[model samples]
Target: MKYTFSILAVILSSTKILIAQTDSLPSNSIVLQPVEIKQYFNKQSILELTNSAHTLSSSTINSQSPTSLTSALNTVAGIRMEERSPGSYRLSMRGSLIRSPFGIRNTKVYIDEIPFTDAGGNTYLNLLDPQSLESIQILKGPDGSLFGANSGGVIRISPQGFDSANDEISLQVLGGSFGLFQQNLGINKKVNDRYQFAFNQSYLNSDGYRENAAFERKSFQTAHQFNYNPKGQLKLFAFYTDLGYQTPGGLTLAQYEENPKSARPAAGPNPSAVEQKAAIYNKTFFSGLGHDYQISSKLSHYIGVFGSYTDFENPFITNYEFRTEKNLGLRTFLSYQNNDLSLPFQFQFGMEGIKGWNKINNYDNNKGVMGNPQANDLLANQQMNLFSRTQLDITKNWVLEGSLGLNKNSIRYETLYPLESQSEGNIKFDNVWMPRLATSYQINNLMALRASISKGYSTPTLAEVRSSDNTINTDLLAEDGINYEIGYKLQGRNKNWLVDLAVYQFEMENGIVRRLNESGVEYYSNAGEMNQKGVELSYWSSWNINTKFLNSIQFNAAITYNHYRFGQYSNANNDFSNNKITSVPDWTMSNSLYLILAKQFQLNITHNHTSSIPLDDANTVFAPKYDLIQARLNWSNSIEKLRTKYTLFVGIDNLLNQKYSLGNDINAFGGRFFNAASLRNAYAGAIISL
Candidate 1:
């Protein structure tokens, strides 16, 4: 693998001079206008921000025909996404994956200003397909000052909207190894200059490489925009998704070596995942309406209202569970900008309120079938936050920003079936406040430096407080922390080279963790304090050649290093202080190269490496390190006679065929820690538009 990368690098560097004779800058170069990042309320350019943020554009997202965000986001530094199965996902941002076994926990997610995360702070990101989004912006590190109850930053997704002048329909089909298949249909149109709409529908199915890991999903999304007045507009969005996937339980070291494809075997009389038909079925629907009112040249107000419903069923090895959830939210903000003053400034103030209700039930599983009831409960959760942020241009070369947020969270549970040792009641955490201060100095046109200090807070989710063990832990408390960071950014004259680097440290208190009992039932507890230090770096460069066969070559590389340890922790008379954090690798690196030919054909190669990861809180067990390589080739053309465009693509994954674990079950009972990734796989697809 090293030899291959060396050769590719040599080839790319040699081409710089070879094509100089025939190469010339293009006659027409389309430049992208600087767009606002809504996370900051459209106050300033994302590139000029004092914090670390990354944006993935539409072309970059569609480059690989991704089925999951795991593929695209894996290249980003400080961001890690793992898919245990086709429809199951776990995300970690500047945090370890120990607390997020199934869904996104610490982070917050948004879709066009509508909260994708419910009031309970659980995000169902797997419901939306990759094709439904136009772009994604990620803010790394603690950002609770504006986004409430989060320690791992934020993600804002922009859905594809209608384009009046480019009305068209598109269809896509793709299939690959392990019975993988996918189909997507999308349409956009305009009724007039005042109204436009876009819609997308997709279906996907996969017979995974591991036993009992089949997956299926059907999703639909619609977005509409209405220009009611010259300075005002109304936006509406609705989406529905039905997802089902089987789970292949983790494997022990001995089991992994014997048969990586095998699911977890039965432990004595306990049934395995395969024997119990362990799976998850989720049907969800959400709708949102937003209005932007331009009150004056420098003042505007925006309001959004959203509602969602989810019906979930999970049949695990221990028991079968069912959940019915409903969520409603309202958000509004006002922005005032004064660019006419000597010291230009922007101020934004906002408030958000969310309420969620859930009915949870557990039953015995009789050979993949629901049996007698075991437990029944009802939970209600609520959160409200008020925030304000201001940015001031202190000077032509310096900028200052500050923000503050006040948050409140509460949860109530009622047990319908009370058996032995049962407790039911309401619990509320004390009101919390988060604040942030940052400054940026523009050294020159091509370079800048920034420093920031921020406070972080995260409330335990309902699922963690009230776990699958059919018990509610009212003792769990919210976690709080502080983060300090400094960063540098640089760009070349022609914008062909770019670099971003950041280093930071964080101190956290009352961190929450999950533990398995002798019966293998999971429960949550405060694991004490923690300390973390990390660094992130990214670089990109591109060379353009006007040769007939070759047009451009681009390279991208990113690396992340972390040192996380327990500051003070002891459990069951066991001294675990100063131990490494579980499920967090010490280092991760990613590199990619792209070759473009005559604006018609392109080839991309990517490599990723992860160091060993601790599997248990004791640091006695670890998962081995691994490397991965993938490549893709695409060809596109426009047929003038038919007035249509078409594209064909082929790709290969895990070229090295390394037997590794893509996702691990931390602190798993019975030594069930590893979930093997797929072997070498190949896929092909095509797209047509009219």
Candidate 2:
């Protein structure tokens, strides 16, 4: 730790002291500018922001293959994105994956200001096409200040829509090893001053490395804005997605080394993954409407309404599960500012509510087909969050902010088949108030420091309450935690270098954890308590010495080191007090380099390293550390005669073809823990913009 910090300090000092580079200037060259962050209630420049946040711009997202977000997202510190298979994504923020088996949990995701997470507290991150993303803003730590009830963190996604000034169209097509094929089309137009629209369509298919691990997706999305008055605008966002993916069960260590690409085979009395045709099928349609109104110079009103319906099916080794889910939500807020107070202040208050209805059924899995009925159930889940914030400028260079949210969650479920003791009931949680106190001080234009203390509360999702064990467990407790964080941001000479540092400690209670039954079906239980602490650092540099040798250079490096321990934790079978957390690596690092050559050619290379992780609470088994390397090269130029621009690119992943598991099933019953990720693969693609 000491060595790392010393090296980082040396880099910072040298960058700030070094003489600014000089280069021949182009008359029409683009200049760098300050980027504003909108994740909070107010807009602030990146340098002065109080919270720890990272933004993945379109330029960064486009540097990798268009197949998935795995490569682009890993560049951010304190985040791990894993693809168990194509179209099946699991995200871990703060290195906590205790409750998630598949999909995203403990975190909140918003798409174009719409709540894509729904009322279930689960995020189907793979449903959206990667090509449709424009930017992603990640807010780290437990912050329930404005967004609502969450413990892990928050992710705000701005899709390819929302840009009103873009008047062009773009298309992309890519194919690669492992039977990968993808196509994307994007169009945006500003039709006069009162109307604008954007549309995106994508098709993706991949035959994954493992047997029976095939995936396909078709997605269409659109956004429109109407200006009814000079001070008001109404926006509409909608999307339809049809997705199918095969879920190859985990493989044992022996199987992984013998045949890395083979699916899970039968164990003792269980069937093989191929025999049961394990997979997931989902079809969904979602839409949202938002209105922004400026009532006067000092006040504004904003409201958003969203709804989604889903048809989901999952054929697992234990059962064939099917569900129909409907969700509706509304978010509205009012902002008022006043300079009359002793300190200039801004105040915002809002209310958010979401309700979801899920009709779930489980049938016997007979060679991928449904057989006798097992369990039938219906559940209605609702969540309400009322939030308020007050921001005061104590001085020209200092800010103080306080925010709070009151949340309440409830679930009602009924069992229609296989009557049980707890056939029907309502479980409600008392209203809890989560508050945040934050302050930031900008010492100068080049350096700033900030600190925050916040409370977090998260209710278990429907899936966790009624897990695949085919039983409803209302005894499950909600998870709550408190986080203390401090951060520093710096910009070096000529603003060519930037650094971000954050340190935090979180203490949580009643942490939800996953458990498995004899049949390999999953259930949920609450671990007593947990203690987590971590440090995250990010460095970025851009050299302006543009020349034919190296027209431009962009470099980014991120690192995370965390220590987690179980606090007063015990289970029915074992006492796991003071043990290490499961599936959390001790340290992770990612680095990327981008070089523009001769103005029209570019090369990008990235490397990622993750340390070994304990596979269970007992800390008896661990997954070894691994390193990954990926690179891409592209050339782009304009066809002035046709008013168009084009780019051709090729990339390869897992350059060393190292065998590793991207996602692991912690505490597997039969030690079937690892899922082999794809080996060395290559892809090529082209994009035309007009």
Candidate 3:
């Protein structure tokens, strides 16, 4: 630690000396004004902090009008998003995907400061359409001091918030192979310089590549912002979605080699997914409101409230499941800035709380229909967080930040059918305190260096506690860890190029892992200890060509190199100590090129490569490497007199036609583990505005 600080001090001193020497430029030399790149400056400001963060703007997201979030997020370094099917996704950041199968875990997610991850530590990222989002911010590594208990990281989403512009309506449509189709309608308006309103409705349907792998969705969303007073602002958001998607069970290597497009075969008395109509049906409604009040010049306050309800159903080869879930939450914060002091300083404190209740039932599946009830239970979960943070500028070129977080989590369960006296109970974990200390040293306006050390904590989710095995594991315990990171950033002269680099190491105890039984049911267990070390790098550069054929060209690349291994892992007397972690690739890279032509046309080409991945802790089986290529073309025109605009686009994905498995099942009892990705496909779409 002392060595790190010594290096920082040296860099600071050298930069100061250089600044003194270059205080004035020669009169004969001409200064090249910095080019103004109308991008996410907010993201750059955030990056100046001691944490590693990235932002994906609307332009990057709409580059090809992606149908899923996986496409937009895949370009981010150290983050991996996989889609097992059209509507089913799994996300992991700087960690292996062994703990999650279908949903988001070890990470906290928020939409416009509203918690999308419930009290149970689960995030339904697939619920929101891609078009509804304007930007996304990702904080890499554990950030428990500010975002609460999460081992992986935090993600914040901003939906097209409160646009105060001319009123307009738009429509879009697209279709492609395998019976894919999409249609959308949207409108935005601002009234009296005080109120803004926006609404969107969309429908999506597709017949997937494999049998019994269809998907359908209908969504409606609306937002309103009211600046009714000079000192206050209020914002409201609401959405409803009805979604259904089929589940194509995994296949073994032998089975995949024989017939890659076939679903899993029946075993013993259990029926196949196709025969039992295995699918997920979900309907959800969510609403939230936030208010900001400027109580005084030195102090300000903000409060937000949110609620959600879901009705969900699922049918599998062995049984059928139904659940009704409800959630409610509140967030409040107060901030104070001190202008009276010689140096600028700020202090902030906040509290957040959430509660979730669920009624779940499992029944026997009688050929795609529910038969007799097998298990019935009601579960309640709750969490509360209190945090305080302070920032101070010790000098003109150095800053310090510190924060503390206190968290409490608990759960209760009651059995309602075939009940026993011991089935009704409650489980509570001890409260924990997390702390962070970080520093940032500005070498110059275009370069900065940072370092930090922090503690992390993550508790078991409700599903992991009482899972498909129909057992409540009271012995489960929360995982705890510590992280250390150092990073550097540089912006090329003239602001035409940017580079970000970071290196980090993490160690955790009582790591959680997934397991499956002979009945094909899922459960969780603890792995002894784990260690991870990695490096991440991202680069961006652009060139402008004022010619008749080309206007500008942009290039981006992100790469990750990781080394993860278990310290002391033993499962059923099988020692896996010092072996590689499951489902983690050694290297992953993404590159893209964008071209603007004649100020009215655009072309984009993207490439992605992933190295082989270990399938299990034993590291015996491996999934091969794969590469993907995609391209898109778009043209836009506007009629000024009529106040109208139109755009047409065409795209092709998987242009290389590489056979691959996008979302691979980590471990299986019957050797069923591969989920085939889509083949080469093309899509064309058009949009109209007025």
Best by TM-score: 2
Models 1 onward score TM values of: 0.95, 0.96, 0.93
How many clashes show up per model? 0, 0, 0
lDDT of 2 at 235: 87
- Residue pairs whose backbone atoms clash in candidate 3: none
Error of 3 at 119 (Å): 1.3
TM-score winner, 1 or 2? 2
Stretches of model 1 off by over 4 angstroms after superposition: 1-39, 162-166, 190-192, 419-423
The number of residue pairs in model 1 that clash at the backbone is 0
lDDT of 3 by residue, 1-690 (tens): 232244335444433433333223222111212222111111125335677777787667778546788876888889999987788899998877888877887888887767888887877788888876767878888878777888788898877646446487888899987888988887887776888888888898999888788999999998888988988999998999999999988888998778877777787777888899999999999988989888888788889999899998999877898989899999888888775787877777998899999888899988789999888888899888898888787877777788888988888898887666337788887798989888888798788899988887888987788777766777888887898989997765445556778899989888888888878788898897889888888766565555789766666777788898998999887899989888888888887788878858889888888888888778888889988888988888988998889889999989999888778887776777888888798888988898
Candidate 1 per-residue C-alpha lDDT over 1-690 given as tens digits, one digit per residue, 9 for 90 to 100:
453355346545643543343433332221122234454787455347798887776656666536777877887889888887777899999987878777887898988888889988889998998987878888888888888889889998888773233487889899999999999998877778888888999999999999999999999999998988888989898999999999998999999999999988899768988999999999999999999999999999999999999999999988899999999999899999988999999999999889999999999988789989889888999999899999999998898999999989999888887566455678899898899999988888778899999988899998898897888788999888999999998766555556788999989888888799889888888898988899988766666765789777766777888899998898898888999988899888887777787778888888888889999999999999888898888888888899888889998889899889988888999899989889999889988998
Q: Which stretches of candidate 3 lie over 4 Å from their true place?
A: 1-47, 163-167
Give the worst 10-residue stretch by lDDT in candidate 2.
24-33
- The TM-score that candidate 2 achieves is 0.96
* All candidates in order of TM-score, best leading: 2, 1, 3
